[model samples]
Target: MLRALVIVPTYDERENVPIVVARALAATPDDVHLLIVDDASPDGTGELADGFAATEPRVHVLHRAAKEGLGPAYLAGFAWGLERGYEAIVEMDADGSHHPEDLPRLLGQLTDHDLALGSRWVAGGRVENWPRRRVLLSRGGNWYTRLALGIDIRDATGGFRAFRAEALRRIHLGDVASHGYCFQVDLVWRALQAGLTVIEVPIVFTERVHGVSKMDGAIVAESLRLVAWWGLRRRLRAAFELVVHRRRLRSVRANSSRVV
Candidate 1:
């Protein structure tokens, strides 16, 4: 049985936190675990997490000093999952924007792929309760990312995702340059560059009903600029392709040279 660990990043999501956690636990099979990385939310979320941990053996929490954005919290969670020998690691929001029931569906992709994205922009996916403006903006952003990154995956900024342990190992967390939602896009690009299998699963995204949205113009602007900057860096892109090529070449040459 594979040991799957779902990493939920929380910040002042007091009302939504327990609901998300409970739903995830109920939806997932026994082999899966949950790790909540709280940013020491001012609303006493950390204490709530601690209390939950005491009763639920599969639930654990990591409390940071303050809000550090989504990327860093996920990185911390990934490191924690790695240290504990988890076979699959997942990322989801604690605000219930990401459906807990989708966890198994994402994990199922690892049977044939290295990463699975719960994509709202895919053919069978949709978004509910988002203002028309936000919907258009998100679609446009995703379109820009796909064109710039030259990747086929939908919903590049989607946070609900599952990674095969090997895929996670290939991604050097220290080298990730972006934070917030852009970080999600950058990581997917890296995974594809490494020649890992990437799959997108359709999902309906709904705005969090109980908490304030963490996304804002700042996040949107950062994502646009960062992805564009990545696209414009031709030299850097070449270097990245070269590294992947060299790695593949070495593996091929080593296999051919072996005396069997």
Candidate 2:
């Protein structure tokens, strides 16, 4: 029953937005509000969200001037929810791939964790109606992410996640630069770097039946590049710190021997 704001970012999702909004609201009836961050969809997705907000007090809308990307839209939503004093902020899809019925379970994990990530690779987690190739792509990408980033998360790229407001503050949103689905990996990296408690909640992922998926070759490429770069940078920094520590220790020993 935390004061939670579910942020759903959309671009040209006219067919799925209303359905998602209604179902999310119905699934989490109390103390959970919906914020539709519409990126000025040419299909009038923003207008549809406004219509819902006008009638349902629990629904809210944030209209952006243009489609920037998923990262920026969610950043804006986080800011909005934080300013209004929401205890938890959630990232959800407007395409219905992330089931609204599973939202409560994600929130439930927040009781003892800083972040609750809805994962498809964990025990009891499964996906439906996904092609074999798509399934392989997702599984391979997640495995690569874990190996390259050295993070224990099984689904760092999954967009279905919940964050305690304090955890978001600790992650330093101002430093985030990723714009695509890699943004999910970036946030997870930052959360781990910041030493925040993170847990994964298993959920069933269903492929969107409506609009075309936003995934593309470019997004996958970006994730690969960023993950590699982060891993390398982390190793270099650790090596440098170790060298510095050793040098300091040697100097301290030499000075002590001289004094003796």
Candidate 3:
């Protein structure tokens, strides 16, 4: 039995936290536990999390002092899961963009994969209630990152994902530099580089109606810059390897032909 834990990062998401927690718990079997990482939202979300943790055996809470970036919160939660011997772990939003019902499907894909991504760019996935600009912005970012990273996984920036604990343990947490949405892209790229199998599970991303969205132009811009930088570095490394191989091949051919 793979003991799983869902890490939900919350900031001023008072109204939707309880609902999302319940739905996530109800949508899965009774064994999957949840850890809500609240960044001390002024909306009393931390207290609410405490109340729920008091009652639910599988539910836990980690209340931070202030609002930090999403990646750091999840990093903390990941460490917590690791310490407790969780076999698998997941990261999700408390604003309800990540559907609780989709957790099972993502987990199921892990049987044959090292990581399973809930992707919006894959077939059968959709976005709901987003403005035209938001859609275009997201689509453009996804396409740009895909080309820049030279990777094929759709929805590279999607946060709804499941990882085998051993795989996550292999990745260096200190080397993960991205502090925002781009963190997802960095992790996926690094996991691929480590020769781990990653599969996409189609999912719909819905805009939250009750709370302010954490997505911003700055995060998108940061993603573009970081991805481009990594892409250049990867390309340069590959070019160097190719040159070395070609030189070796030419030397071998000259020795073998021996026409002189």
| Candidate with the greatest lDDT versus the true structure | 2
Best by TM-score: 2
Q: TM-score of the candidate numbered 2?
A: 0.97
**Clash count for each candidate, listed in order shown:** 0, 0, 0
TM-score of each: 0.89, 0.97, 0.95
Q: Please write out the lDDT profile of model 3 over residues 70-143, one tens digit for every residue.
A: 88899999999999999899988898888999999988887898899998888999999999998888788888
What count of clashes does model 3 give? 0
RMSD of each: 6.2, 1.1, 1.5
Off by over 4 Å in 3: 257-260
lDDT of 1 by residue, 1-260 (tens): 36899998898988988899899999998999999899989999888999999999989999898898888889999999999899999998888888999898999889999999999988999988999998888889889998887778779888999999989999777798677889899899889888988999999888989969888888888899988888778458789999999999999999988944
When summed lDDT is taken over every stretch of 10 residues in candidate 1, the lowest stretch is 229-238
Can you list the residue pairs that collide in candidate 3?
none
lDDT of each: 0.89, 0.93, 0.90
Superior by lDDT: candidate 2 or candidate 3: 2
TM-score comparison, 1 vs 2, better candidate: 2
Give one digit per residue, the lDDT tens place, for model 2 in 1-260: 68999999999999998889889988995799999999999999999889999999999999999988899999999999999999999999999999999889999889999999999999999999999999898899899989988888999999999999999999999978889999999999999999999999999999998999988888888889998999899889999999999999999999999999
- Candidate 2 — which pairs collide? none
